[model samples]
Target: MNNPVMEQSTPRNVSRRGLITGTGSLLGSAALGGRALAATPRHGRAAAPGAAPRDASIADGAQVPALVIGSGYGGCVAALRLAEAGVDVQLVEMGMAWDTPGADGEIFANTTDPDQRSYWLRTRTKQPISNFLGFPIDRDIARYTGILDAEDFSGITVYQGRGVGGGSLVNGGMAVTPRRENFGAILPTVNSAEMYGTYYPRANTALGVAAIDPDWFETTECYQYARVGRRHAQRSGFPFVFVPDVYDWAYMKQEAAGAVPKSALAGEILYGNNHGKKSLQKTYLPRIRATGKVTVSPLHKVTTVRPASGGGYTVTLEQLDTGGATTATKEVTADRVFFAAGSVGTSKLLVALRASGALPRLNEEIGKGWGDNGNVMCGRANHLWDPTGSLQSSIPTAGIDNWAAGGAFAEVAPLPTGIETFASFYLSITRNPHRAEFSWNSGAGRVELNWQTAWKRESIDMAKSIFDKINAKEGTIYRTDLFGTYKIWGDHLTYHPLGGAVLGKATDNYGRLHGHPGLYVIDGALIPGNTSVNPFVTITALAERNIEKIIATDL
Candidate 1:
């Protein structure tokens, strides 16, 4: 879901490929000249053996049967299915391939020690948790195209992954599916029976979703923090559930046993996991490549999609360099286009296109029903006796489920600061009803979100329904040092940005755009806001269902 931070002003007419090449040269020259030495690898992990195969960039004036706008979950699914049906597909990603190692020799940077690879084209890192123990934790880094993108709107910062695999590369790997009873609310137009009976199982199997070894979880040193969280949840009468994840539990066990290089146990979930976690690069992209009918172009951004002079759609693209500069501009024609560039990316592009008259027939619901999935972060200060572990696993395996009773489900997140902080961290997904909209601001020449930060108050209140009671029962207070000076709620950012292009209103039941025959929205933008849990599994399953239908009938 290549979501780059929106620039306030209109972009310069520079080539994206030139910028990337210049940036890469700058980094390479610095490393060779000894001005920028790569940091030593941590956690006993070795450097990446070598670079992986590169995806060919798209040429100007090329024509394709299908153009998938993103390499995220939905785009990958669409490309694979379309290719399997003997259709030639071209997938364009706005970020780097991430197949090559950096100056550090590792494919990704560590969470504790962020480098240039930590953020997307930012001079500094904007960590989700900005503070720790009353001190700011952000640091400066070289400006190159990185993995995570903290895209800022008016009132909120939407965090998205910037590389080929999209959000899967930077996420916590919590592949959660909503409870069957709650499925109706998540996607009311979709058939729940088909989803639960077929698509859900299919998605889960493809994603390698699995539960933790409960017996080992009870006694593992790395999961001691989770155990402490469970004890507090049980004492407070909240249901503590073991959340399944996409991480390879077997590799994690090997990490714990010191038999393999540590990843999850070494706090490696934020930037990108070098091992253990099964990101889309390891899962879907490999299969998509195997089909040989789908060609992917990383660092290629789709800028416009208009009706071609002759037939099909004319797709304009900008080839970006590592430094986020445009090195080349290419125009291609596609018989069909699938918008899967995440919620923010897809919504911004659609709103701009509609307002600019490129796609004038696009419906009025283009940029409506955007949500943050009610994301809020807080920490609980525990007594010294209940130390929440010095060593913690970066992969979250448990959560406090109060969704039905309190409208909040909090994952017992890890605070892997390499020391015992005597605090328990939680990222709660509450049932926040406030949905923002993305609109084309003619004055600014950019898409703006009409989201007031105050809207998060509802989310805060819902989250309080769970933590406030826990605080009362456990006699613990909310930790104010993690967010800011005396600030308890980390409400400024959201990892799960859902909606903007809703299913029924913005698109048909099968994700076909209402007014456009060949355009489709097949990503998180299809889900209207909250999913009552992590949304990736739902997104994948929904895509599975939609693409299957499209292939059977439309294609």
Candidate 2:
């Protein structure tokens, strides 16, 4: 259904509860006034005063002042910032426009009782951990409006969020910014001093990030798993540190006190949080909608982007129904286009367009230098004395940072099923240098990422160094039953896929595509290989830096 662009009318600096009310309208409207575009041929025609684009028609398709693809971190930030600069902006997302409740009166499904709303476009459920003790834990479900999208490549399966808010919807809310020392290596061309001093802080404030309450964290069941990881790491003589998150600390306290329906305490991650977690839908998106100059279109996927004969560019869109089937094809024109479709999403489009001769001027570096962010998941078999609580919390607050020595940041993740299992699960982020490329496969009519399953060995080795030290200290062994019967390494997939269309290679220093003047790539696609952290903060920061430049010169 094509939704209306609704008014914001919420309080200034609204609470997350405000999202509960505006979310429906947010999706229905999509972005700002996200509705059907005008079909009139748009060539050098100025928008009539009070004539919304959704209300007018161009001869060929819709004509927009600026168009942003993907409502993820980069897109949302771009939309909000541009609108704030008095520019008309429209955002198109290829996923569900959330906000409507299902028959069960819930906005989303839980990680435990996964339903049709658990996954995106998949007949079977894909919980990150596919097995328990060599037994497959996956289930078949009717494909519907799920949140988490397990985008499968030839070699690796990437778990990303699919919806209006993008990664913010399904992630664990770990809003990590890369260390200042690592900025030079990650972005290569960006100025480190300016980013660390200005943009990073701007991104953090905009994200509403906050550290866990030290007192509550020390006592709550939510962090017992983290504490266990810390103890193990400390015993092994490794450094441990707290990780900040976008979740509301006050709300989390209420959940732990039984004052509210438990979300984090109820083992809700990967799917979505019913409350507390400050996903982008609860933050940037709402602000963008309030701007009045921004509009959003959800369930609309941008298929192609090429420079128009006159000026600006023409964008093709495929609209998908609730069943994830294409319902309609559309065309739109924009004076300026920004690509914020995450790393894989943007790379797929750029690589395909270049191969198809849609935008042959694109640089040869469009789909190169992609990595898994050194991500590895493993579970440790703990002894009877080291019982890692049955009633665990899903929100991780602490991590074992042996990055200086082992190049690893191990967050003590949880298997919170309300059952006492003597196992400790951890997801470590290491510095894996293995990079790959994405190329268009004409035979398959799709983009193929040339990442090898074996490339994650460097990450695995880094992770093993720390775990091995902990295992020696605690007399523990690796759990062979978690991933598969005898399988141990969770290297075939990654939750963090970095690179593809790297900064300073595929695009200019400030994310302006090298060959396409008005086209910009502003997502993880801009990062070379890895951010050495959770990446959302870095993505938001780089966008802030680049968009500021774009506004000053291009606008």
Candidate 3:
């Protein structure tokens, strides 16, 4: 455990280079044994290299009628809709189904005590932001099929999830719809009337969204930090609005009352939530599987894609085992391919495919219009009069809306350490017009993001506009203990990465890639960044609208 004296002594303004390292722990906890889940079956055994494909059914490489490249919100929507319309679909995911139980029978490793199961195919943990202080909190662990992925680009580190549920698995459960008035600018091609009236409600209902009981929120000890944030923001002449989340508020109440073992209470998020949070693994994917027409291929990465000689597309995949070793290579022919592989995933693939000439005429706009969703994270050291609770819930339930003047929507985030640190954290979503481009770097054999460290200054300025006011009103200093001592701003990482293949430009208004009839880009890649809130709801609603169009016209 980190000593209070050491935490206080840790300088708040460490260099970015000095912040990241594989040093010893500042805080530590032993892995708690999780509740055992039933032993669900895996799809198939992995094959050895140069051997037949793992699944005997697809060993001969049959023609797949409809294919979805990810199992996230967009992909699941595509899969379920297509299946309901009687189009046989195969959904490909690059991570585990997360159904298998661990040795201790837990489905996931707790963030506080991560082991091999804390990351996706990495030797050590790579958190989105490096430290709660100058001290190192990330641990060295074996490679395994973990949930969170902190994918590094040159100028930024993108935080995504590596499981059936994708970002839903690792994200805070806040589900926000973009303000109706602000929706037109981000996606001018999209019909706002339809989005607000038809799709957004449809999506929220399907996503199992519910508000925290306000009466309960006011009294709950778990949410005392949120109340503190609300009070602070209100005191600073900001309206603290209640943000809805996908977590079961009633269950959270149970967790708070010691009726259940601590999961969120124990500070377990940004890895995988063992309880409360409703990831796709719990909701959408299960319903898709119930349709009986969807087959998921996990641990398979599509490395190459090309047009088939006759028609449709041919995709080559490298299958992997739990240890990240290649098991076999195979190909599949698909009549239709839906790119639901989140913004970064789909953009990287598309950029590489275009540069490699596999998708020569994809579009001039294919790799354009990517944004970080204007993410800025910072912490304020509150005075003793305003003590943020030691026991905190990882699920954020409130935010400050300074978007009218400051152009920022800041969430009162959680530290969730079960320890009092006298800090108030805020993650601000700002309005940054600086979008990055992804270009294939043949030398590196990867698609490099054109974003630079300098690009974040715009985002920082927008977020600081709001925070500076709050800090001035409250007379509290920014916390140097979180994200590095005195490194108050976490400007290099983004959990909400949006756009690459934008809505109207990269593809048509309905997300169909311009030149390719059956190829579509449907995820966050379709939204040209800045959803004006947490993005999953907009991503879901837009996907709903697009799939409706394709099913009615294109199919």
Candidate 4:
């Protein structure tokens, strides 16, 4: 059975709507025109007008126009724009493409399996790996893993994807735009309308962002999840709202017809959504590749970036799976390089590269101003109606903006599904913690993130009051400060990790390394502050905005 939704057009379908508005044919014609822009063989003759040149076939250390280290949303967008601008772009991803594993056998790239804990960073104990979410954290080399369990939780949990799509591969696939005030708080100089009004919609359109239709609630397990939210709201006397998820319904419908489950069924994600969910491996990269100039080499972890004597950068990369038979490494040169490996990877790389004197001339601000967006959480409700035989996997689709009312931190978003019966995610974009410090932990062979979170009297009061309001409503609700409980559960769960390589008057607004002209940080690390809401849309907007600047320079 085919997905009836996908096979047809709907008003909610932006492209279909665009067609009705006359823009559909325009986009269609543009795509039709782009066909001639396909990739040309390395040794072949010059390509047609829009054709992207092939860089993979080139010899070792090939010189390209742009080099993007991580193939996540940021890298993919940068590659596409640069390539379409006629720049030769090479996109390298640390994780390989996802391969569905068999029941008896295991596949290295499929972390979606129940047995793998590769998605969350966890403390390995004799007792199953326990984090705030209380889920097992498997650090398997297989399943194209990401850095799930960050050693430090005061900052953010910092979930990173290793495969072709980076965080997009394992993220909740929730595309949310930060509130106007939150966005302004971080990048004060940014014009709200320019980003939110214009760019935000464009980003959503390009990514095919849409809310899960009400039918998803009426016809599937989504309703069950909503019921859990409603019951909690009713019992606690707090309001509950539906959250929009980026999980493609059309695709999920198809997967269901084939007997594949959907994330709505308590399908534990964050480890990886085996059930059809929004993993970037299936989203942005393909169209970006279609621009013809972008080529992604999965399982290629970037090791270093050195400025070439004359121009551009020399990027070093290594294959992820040689069975560790040998750590074969390679390097290539590019006129421009974008680091989209998220905060942990990008900050670590920059800090290491600078500290090792690879780019000794980097400014003092190279690895300074690190923050985890001051995340805090307090959940209260007057209900204990935990639904059985259902998965509460999706987090908050809607949130309140009390943070603006002189409340605690920034804002609070709901935590959806979990191993336990009663748990909700509460994210705070409160007072930006005095930036965390970053250093290489040679003994651990990883970056060490250290920060001291101070409780602002007002923020704490606000947090407590927010819960108080809910408690006054109906039933019993509990308050848990994620950071306060860090000693026990190790920094409650946070999918959003930000800062490290911050942007401001200090660093170039576009996140270019202060003194290093060709180096740019396009990942979450570049975000100067955090938002109370999910940070994906904000990250995407910043990336999109930055790439536009990079291309305007034609470097």
Best by TM-score: 1
Q: How does each model score on lDDT?
A: 0.83, 0.77, 0.78, 0.54
Q: What TM-score fits each model?
A: 0.91, 0.89, 0.90, 0.74
Q: By how many angstroms RMSD does model 3 differ from the true structure?
A: 6.2
Residue lDDT tens for model 4, 1-555:
011112112223323222232222223222212222112112233322222222343235788877888877777777777877887777876654544333332222122233323432232211111322222323222321333434344434454565566676566666777667666777776677789877788777776677766665555543454455455444543444455567766766554455564453434454455545555554566567677777667557778888888788887777655222225678788887788887777878888888777877766665666655555555432233443212333433444445555344323332332223343435444554456667767787766766544423333455544555544443333422222321212233345667778877335877677777888888788776465566777787878888888779745
For model 4, state the Cα shift of residue 145 in Å: 4.5
User: Candidate 3: where is the Cα deviation over 4 Å?
Assistant: 1-60
Count clashing residue pairs per candidate: 11, 13, 7, 25
For residue 269, give model 4's deviation from the true position in Å.
1.5
What lDDT is obtained when candidate 4 is compared to the true structure? 0.54
Q: Indicate the worst ten consecutive residues by lDDT in candidate 3.
A: 21-30
lDDT of 3: 0.78
**lDDT tens digits, residues 1-555, model 3?**
011112122444433322321111133111121123223223335432211122412332868998789878899889988998999988888887666556654667766566777777788777655565455456667777677787888888888888777888888989998888899887898889999999999899888998999999899888889998988888777888998999977778889889987778867787788777877776777677677788888787888778999799998887778888879888989998999889999999999999999988898897789999999898776666676786888889889998877788999998665566666888999988888898888998888988887888988887777677777777655655446644668888898999999988989889999887899988999988788899999999999999999999978
Off by over 4 Å in 1: 1-53
lDDT, ranked from best to worst: 1, 3, 2, 4
Q: Which candidate, 2 or 4, has the higher TM-score?
A: 2
Estimate, for each residue in 1-555, the C-alpha lDDT of model 1 and write its tens digit: 011222112124213432332233233222222233245233222313221136478889999999999988988889889999999999899987777655665688878777788788898878887764445657778887888998888889999998788999988988888889988889999899999999999999998899999999998989999999999889878899998999999999999899998898888988998878888887888888888897778889888999998888999999988889999999999999999999999999999999999999999999999999999998776766787776799999889998898789999999776666667889999899999999998998998999889999988877888777777776666666556655778899899999999999999998999888999999999999999998999999999999999999987
